[model samples]
Structures are given as C-alpha cells and as structure tokens.
Target: MRISRLRFPVLLAAVSASLTLHAEQTDLRVSPPGWWAGMASPKLQLMVHGPDIAGSTVSVNDSEFVIEQVNSLDSPNYLFIDIDIADISPGDYELTFTKQGKEIYKTIYTFRPRAANSAERQGFTQKDTIYLVTPDRFANGDESNDSVAGFVDKADRQAPGGRHGGDIQGMINHLDYIASTGFTQIWSMPLLENAMDDHSYHGYAITDYYRIDPRYGSNALYRQFSQQADEKGVGVIMDMVLNHIGSNHPWMKDKPAKDWIHHNGEFSATTHRRESLHDPHGVEADQKAFSDGWFVPSMPDLNQQNPYLTNYLIQNAIWWVEYANLSGIRVDTYSYSDKAFLSQWTARLTSEYPNLNIVGEEWTTNPVITAYWQEDSYRADGYDSSLPSVMDFPLQDTLVNALKDEETWGTGLVSLYNLLAGDFIYGDPYNLVIFGDNHDMSRIYTQLDESYALWDMAMTFLLTARGIPQIYYGTEILMANPDTDDHGVIRSDFPGGWKNDSIDAFAQQGLSPKQTKAYNRIKSLLSLRKEHPVVTQGKFTHFAPAEGIYVYFRTDEAGKGAMIILNKNEAENDVQLARFEPVLKEFSTASRWGNSNKISVKNASIEVAPKSASVWLLQ
Candidate 1:
C-alpha cells in the first residue's frame, strides 16, 4: 500500500483535539479547513475526520453559526456537518462533539474575513492571453525541498519521468519574464500533493484536496505566488481534477462511505469513448464504462453520485478559488465525472461568483460534441450546462492539419476555413480557449515537423483569432520532442530554469539562429494582441481560401481593427486588394502592427513574403 502523510490544512488548523486511533494522536482533520462570512451562499459543509468519530453529535456553542445537520455513515472515522454560516463574524468558534451525553471531542473552528468586492471579481476573458506552464519542468528556483521526507517521488534530472526540483518559488521567480512575454495569465498543471511512488511529476493524481504539494511549495507560498502575479498584471488560473485521486490518498485507506469511489475502488479502464456523453443512441453500459471507469489503475475514479462526496468536491473547488484569490480554473477530465453533479457543481460556483470563468477539457475534434457542454447551447435532452468555456480542440486539430498537409481542393488551408465557418454552433465562440499545444501532447514545433515557417504562421493566426489564446511554455524557443512522443521529453526543463545551465532562454543566450527568430516573433505577436483592443473584443470575419493563401479580418463596427494574411506559397505573391474590398477599401494605407512600417493599400495589390504571415492595422 502507498502511504500518505497528512498535514495541517492551509486555512484552518485551529482544532484542539479529536478521537485518535493511532499511537501518535493527531488533531481532527477538517476539509475547507475554514470559511469566510458574508459569502453569497449561506451554506457550508465540513468533512471532519478521525478514528471512530461517527455516532458523535456535533453542536456549535456560539450563535453566530448554526449546526443544521450532522451525519455519520458506515465509516467509523468520518462526520459531515452542515452549518448555516450566513452572518458569522470572523473569528474562532468552539465545536463540541458529544456521544451519549458525554463530551467526546472539542475543537476551535476559524472563519476568515472576505476580501473587498471579492464576489464581484471577474475571471480571465478574451482580453487575456494565457501562458500554459508545467511547473516541474519550467524552472527550479529552490533545491532544498526537491526531495521531501514524505513524498515518494524524488528529484532525478537524469530520469525523464522523475521530479526535477521545480517549485512555487520558480514560478514566483519568473513573473517578470511571463509579464514581459505579454501573457496576461498563467495556467500551470495541478500543484497538489501526488504522494505516489513513481512518475508523479505530472500531478494528475491528487492525494489531497485542500493542501498544495510540499514538493511544489507550501499552501501559504501558493497564495503568495497568486498575489504577486497580480502585481505584475498577470492572473493565475488553477488546474483542478474532479474525476479521480491518487491511489495513496487518505480516503482510499479509509473510505468515508462504501460508495465513495466508483466500481468499488477497483480499477476498470475507461473505453475513452468521450462521445458517449452526447451520442443520442449511445448504449447505457458504454456510457457507464466511460464515466465510471478510471484512466489508470493507479488513480481511483470518484463517485460524485454520492451526495456527501458531491458536496466535498464542490466546496473544495470554492475553497481554492477564495483561498488563493485565483482568477479562473481549468477543469481536467470534465465529462468523466457524473453528469448531474457537474451541473450542480458549476451552478453553485457561478452563483457565488457570477462572472467567474471555468473552462473544461473536452478533447474532441468535433465542434458539435464540444458545444454540447457550454452554458447557452440548448440541448434537446433538457440538460443545461453552466460552464462558461471549453478548450477548442477542433480548431487546434484543424490548424495543425492545415499547415502540415499539402494544399489541394479540400485539403490544406480550406479545411481550416470551413471549420471556422461552423462557429455558429457555439453559444459564445469568443469565450473558448484556443491553443496549438499543451502539456498533454507533443509541442507544436514537433507536430509541424520542425518547420520554422509553419510555426511562425500558426502563432500569428492563433494570436489574432477570436478566442482566448494559450501558448505552451517553451513554444517561443522552439522546444520539441523529435522521434518520440514521451510526455516527459515534451515537457523537458526550460533552458535557464536550473543552476549552471549552458543555455539561458530567459536571457536569450546560446540559442540557434532559428530559435532566436522564433522567440522574437512570438513575443512581438503577443505584444500586438496585448496593445490592440480590437483583437480581444472585435468581431471576426474571413474570406474563403483560394490558391495557397488564406485571409481573415477582425474589426469593430467602425473598421478599427487588423487585416491578416497567411501565405503558404514557395514564391512571393501579390495579394489582390480587390478581394477584400468591403473592409480594405476605406483605407489608403496600412501600418504594420509589430514593426510600425508602412504599407500602401492604394494599389490593386500588395506584395507579401513567401511562406509568411503578415498583419496590418486599419482604421
């Protein structure tokens, strides 16, 4: 059995004592650990854990909070307390536990003060460009905590799958670099404890819901990182897992209920038929296999159908958003969780923070399947989703194929144009998160067969597209995993992230001619998006692809926006201005957005470089 050591939760460790079953007595463990008063929702559920603590009636001595109900299940070690926390003041309250009229346990519960206008906060939007990072491979700012005592995964730079000493301090150390890159937001993989014995660097199998991994940093440090990122004009987006937990999680050792885990805590691999959730004629057993099955034997699928477990997942998500003061969240394996519970989960979160953004990962190349989960899309089955955004897998797939495949009648760039033409299916197309590559797949550079020209065009189109653009960590420097798709190789450590590295990506030292150009071009494109409001809030328009050229435009009603052209020809081509007369006729001249050069539109055509993407600002 994999052993996991429990630590005091971040917000609430004020408990005095509780029933103990071990040789060394430990305080009562509470999830949420604590909560704040004056929240939009007056409800709070606390999952108190210890040894044989059931059959204990809970009571709040103070009138500020009321104990609505107390429930104990088959497990002798767990208690669920429902409290009405509407007007409680910010302080400690004594919770007394009695069994058979005898005081069995007592503890002090803490309530923290809410930040000013917290509920009125907004999440990441089309205006923000997100930089996706893998914290373990990004940088290692601290080596002292590289191999902690409890976590089995140790630091081994030689092993591609082992931890490489990256910590929260590394992210804190690079905020200036991130901000200078012109990205307004950062979405790293989950930083929660993974207490497994092997390959835990990916952080997908979570061992604790309320605590940040010590190998990454303490929970207090994570909060500090979020606050500091805000100082640099960049928001933090958390990656949350709702479908499964690490096999070593404390719950696996002592389940709160018999149905806490799906398939009775046994591993049953998923068929990975994600389309089953939306298939009109999908079989019931196939749907159950897709949702209830685990991704791997090492991770246990959660049973959200259990009401108590549902509350636990929802409250945990809210606690993180409030505790870390995060700007947004990215849900992992969104459809694998129970469908009804997902609706309730998202509704409760948005009800509290009305404008909050939560994007789900619904990895499918079909836009119709993706659209079935967004909030405003009317479903015939009467299922309403409160989710605000989804990762644009269709666009990502089409973009890569368009650039890599040979141009033909229905082959190359035309395929991409046709996909965008179907955008009417999405309720709010602009809210989607668009990207070329992420932590899960091979880097975009590798996918495009290491062609610098194709890489340049891909970056230009995605950055100017109609949705929130996200770029993987090292795309700017042309990181690639050639001849292999191993995740650890794709997520290799950044050049200057470690001590005594010969190459320093952060300082632009020891780079190839191609690498230097790639870095500069991406930085310029990001700056272009950041300074131009039309790129973020304007309507997108495009013309059909003819020959090897594809063109698009983004503009406000007054025609103040950008004109973009992507050329895949082997020779220079003169793009005819007559083809774009509707929006281009009003301007006699165009100013290059990134370089500030001038281009005259007074003639019938303009000459563009071969195999290049160009952008010009128009008013």
Candidate 2:
C-alpha cells in the first residue's frame, strides 16, 4: 500500500508555539518566490540568490516550516535552504536573514491554498487532440507587448525568423477558434524567457526559467491564459527544455558550482546519437559525449548530475504545475540529459501529481531506442526510466515514408504496418505522442509532395491511430514548405495571424478551394473523434497492407466500431470486407463518417477512392 505523507493536524500542533518575525531586505531573491501550504511533499528547497548571501543565517517566522538544512555552495552569492512545510497553513510568513546576530534582511513568503482537487487534476491523454503552435507566429492580439523596451528581440512581420508578436493574449483571443476546431488541448512552444540576441522567436533556448518572456506576456497573463483555456475545455501543455539553457541565462554569469554546466571551458557540440544509452558495447566516452555535450555553441548543457541542480530542476517543474494549474508537460530533448536524473525528475513530479501527463521527446527513428526510455520498459541493462510517455518518432517516420513510397512488396504501406506490429516493445503504446510534422520537421504537406489526397490520408490515420495525436499549427490549412526544410519556412507565420495578411485561416476566409476542403476535412475528423470514445480508448486492430491499401479498426466492448481505410493507389480499388471479418462480425450497416454515403455490408466489398481515406461507422 502507498503511504500518505501529509498529516496536517500533527504538523499544526508542532508549530503553534513559534513567534512571528518580520524584517525588510532588498538584495535577496528566492526562486519559486513562494509556495503553497498543502503540497503532497512536505519539503521545499529555496535557492536564495544575492551578493554574498551565503554567510547569513536563515530563519522563518512560522514554526510550521523548520529549516532542515542550509547549504552554502562554492559561490557565496547563492544559498540553498531546505524547509519542511508539511504542516503549514495558508498565510503570510516572513523569512529572515541575519549576520552576526543582527537582522540584515527579511522577505515575505506566502503559502497559498491549493486549488480544489488540484492533486487529482486530469492530464492530457489520448482523448485530447493537441494543437501545437509557435506562439510568436500564431497571432498578435496585444500590440503593446510586441516591442517591450527591455527585451532584445523585436517584432518583424517581414522576417520569417523574427518575432511576429504572437502573445498569450492572442491565444486567449482565439480560444473560441481553437475550441471550435475541436482541439481539446494546446501545446505552445516554450513561452518562458528566451532572451537571445537573434532567432529568439523559436523560444527553445530559455534564459529565465522562473519568469515568462515580457514580450510574450507577463507571468500573470500566462496564468490567466491557462485558466481561461481550462474554462474553454482546453488543457495547456507547457514545453520545457531540461537539457540546456540559453548562453545568457543568469546561472551562466554566476554558477553556484564548478560543475553546474557541462563543458564550461570550451564549446563541444553533441553527437546527437541517442542509441549510446542502450549500446552494450558502446564506449563510455561516446555516451558521455551524447549526454554531456552542448546542443550548440549558444546553448549550455546543464549538469543534472549535480545533486543541487537536479533538485532545482525538479522543484522548478513542480512550481510551474502548481502555480499555473497546467494539465501536462512536453519535455524537449528528453534523452540528452543524465538518465538517472531523468528518472528521479519524472518520479518526483508523478508522485506529486499522479494523474499529470509528461511526454518526453526522444527523436529517434528506431523503436527500440525510444521504447528504452519509457517507464516499466524491460531493459537488459537494468535501467528503469520513470517517464510516462515518449514521442512516437519511429511510427512517425514510417507514416511519412509509407505515404511517400511506391506500393510494393515489403515496402510502401507495409512499412507502416511493420512499425505498428512492433508496438509490443513499448510499455504503453497508447501514451505515446504521434504527429505528422512539427516545428523541426518538414511540413506534412511538403513531405507528401504537396498531394492533398495524401495529406488527408495522413490526417485521418493520425487521428484514428492508437496514440495521442498532435497537429501542428496551419496543418489543417494546408501549410507547406515545398522548397526547403529550413525551420523558418516550415514554421512560417500562419495565414491571417498577422494584420494586413492576404489570408485569414481562423475565419476560414480568403482560403483557396483546396485549402478550404482540407480545413473542413480536418475539422470534421476532429469533431467526430471528440464525440466517439472508441477512436480514443477502444482496442486498435490493424490488417496487413495489400495492393497499396491499409486498413484498421477501433472497437469498444459495447460493439461500437470505426473502420479506417487508406487507399494509396491512383485508380479506385475494391476492398474485400471479408479481410476485416474479425472486427466486422455482427455489424450489418456502415456509413461514411463525414457524409451520408451508405455502404452495404451485404455486398462484401467497399470501393475506396484512389489516394483517399474512408472512415466508416459500423453498426
């Protein structure tokens, strides 16, 4: 049986006899400025940053939180304090810092009450349709924040890689549009401060972990956005980079320890080879090169092996979840960090929020490498990762390949079939996140040679497949980067996202006929998937590809079933329904999902249009 850590009654009795004290201080700063009273874990570590602050004695006015330990690191400007808050009540308390028996400074720390049922909050799951957006290019609702005085990057609508001024307010303004498109969750790229000199619009290199980028919006605005999105039935999934930080991050200027960052002396780029973790005969130096090497010259790789740094990252994650009431987190470059640290980090978060979902990005085309990082995976090396989910890059790669290849034996559509057949290696296939394309990859349309039919088929398969589906921004509007795979082009500004744009996708105005059809098709599929539980939660069964045709079925115990057929041939093909008899038994009628085209099961055959997807509801 699991144990409960918090016994509020016992804690309150132990701290009732303490005296309250207050003092004023200007130099000291605490990360996660304040915390709540009723956390699942009683312990909280505050990193105090200031000039020569390590020598000062630290004490809290309330006896509820006893300073268990005070750690002074190599840098005298930083001090780490471990406080026990298991029994504290929601109220204001003063934390005092003193030198030689004289009070130097004190900061007011408040313990707020947790939201009702916050611990049990449900996270994003397969039932959710995640809409991913690069906020800087989505829309601009608040022009006031476009060019904040202190920020280095400014809005430049003409530059594909420059900031386009899309802020949280813009996302807030289009909540109705997002909901109307049937997306239940929104996953924006990193919204935290990425105070780089150029190309900061991407938001990958974070300079500040605690504060939101002022150009994007204030921290309060971000919280408000999440709150409003929750009200609109949309959950917010934060994007976090644990492996590295922007070169300009404050920690780089004054590192608390010598090993706070890897490769502190000279620049060393990572090999980007993720297979070293499971490579039995792999060289120890190669593995270190992958984990310890910097992603680039500008991004400093964090040293999670340091116990203090590990705790800081873990606490920062928990703080955001509690402060913003987030539903989930999407970790960037998950496998590049220390494996042991990754396990502890995930375990801590899951312990606090049992239902919260955290999906890690393990960008590999091999299923074995990706599966090795998932929780409960049986690895021969005896390494256990507490990660709940991983990006389905293996399946993603096959999906695109299957669509682009020519129909042949042991090739083309068969590649996708083979990929799905390998699902047994995963701890939980349903928890994996599958997407057609993302900010880093070429657009789905471009990948499919700009074929609208192939694009439709791809969308249909992603939504009906087993794992959680993520749709990149502008995908529904047929966004394409046909000429190049450059990230700037792939993540170009969405139509009508900026003012004076020729096209507006949000309103469905100024779109071409083909674009309109693609948009409507996505909308129809998303709406249908939302209303049907079988697509999201039912058992997934698939058939082998024959003559460039692949078929799959999702069925629940109650007899509700969905049949999805993908026809890759240029000429129409008649699919023999007998091939799917295992799932079709006892069902007499079938109808196309988006239209009222009746299909007769008695005929024992269905005609599928060339290079098109046909989804039918079986009854």
Task: Give the top-scoring candidate (TM-score).
Answer: 1
Task: Identify the runs in model 2 with alpha carbons over 4 angstroms from their true place.
Answer: 1-25
Which residue pairs clash in candidate 2?
none
1-619 per-residue lDDT for model 1 (tens digits): 1111123342134343233423222646888798887888899989998766898998876787788999998799999999988877777676777878876676667788899988978999999999999999999988998999977788998889999988899999999999998999999999998999998988999999888899999999999999999999999999999999999998898999999999889889998898887788878898999999999999999999999999999999999999999999999999899999999999999998998899999999999988888889767788979999999999999999999889999989999999999988888999999999999999999999999999999999999988999999999999999999999999999999999999999889999989999999988988888788887778898999988999898888766878889999989998997889887876777787767678777666767899999998986
For model 2, residues 1-619, the per-residue Cα lDDT tens digits are 1112354344434333232332223456897787887898888888988777777898875677688999888898898988888887776666767878876555566678899999999999989999999999888889988988767778887787888889888899899999999999999999999889889988888998999998889889999999999999999999998999998888888999888999873479899888887899999899999999998888999999999999889989998999999999999999999999998999999999999999999999999999998888778998867888999999888999999888899889999999999999989999999999999999999988899989999999999999999999999999999888878888888888778889999999999999999989999999889888888888999999999999999989898888999999999998989878877885888888988887767648988898999899888
lDDT of 1: 0.89
- TM-scores of all candidate predictions against the true structure: 0.96, 0.95
Q: How many clashes in candidate 1? A: 0
Model 1 ranges with Cα > 4 A deviation: 1-27
For model 1, give the RMSD to the true fold: 4.2
Q: Against the unseen true structure, what C-alpha lDDT does each candidate score?
A: 0.89, 0.88
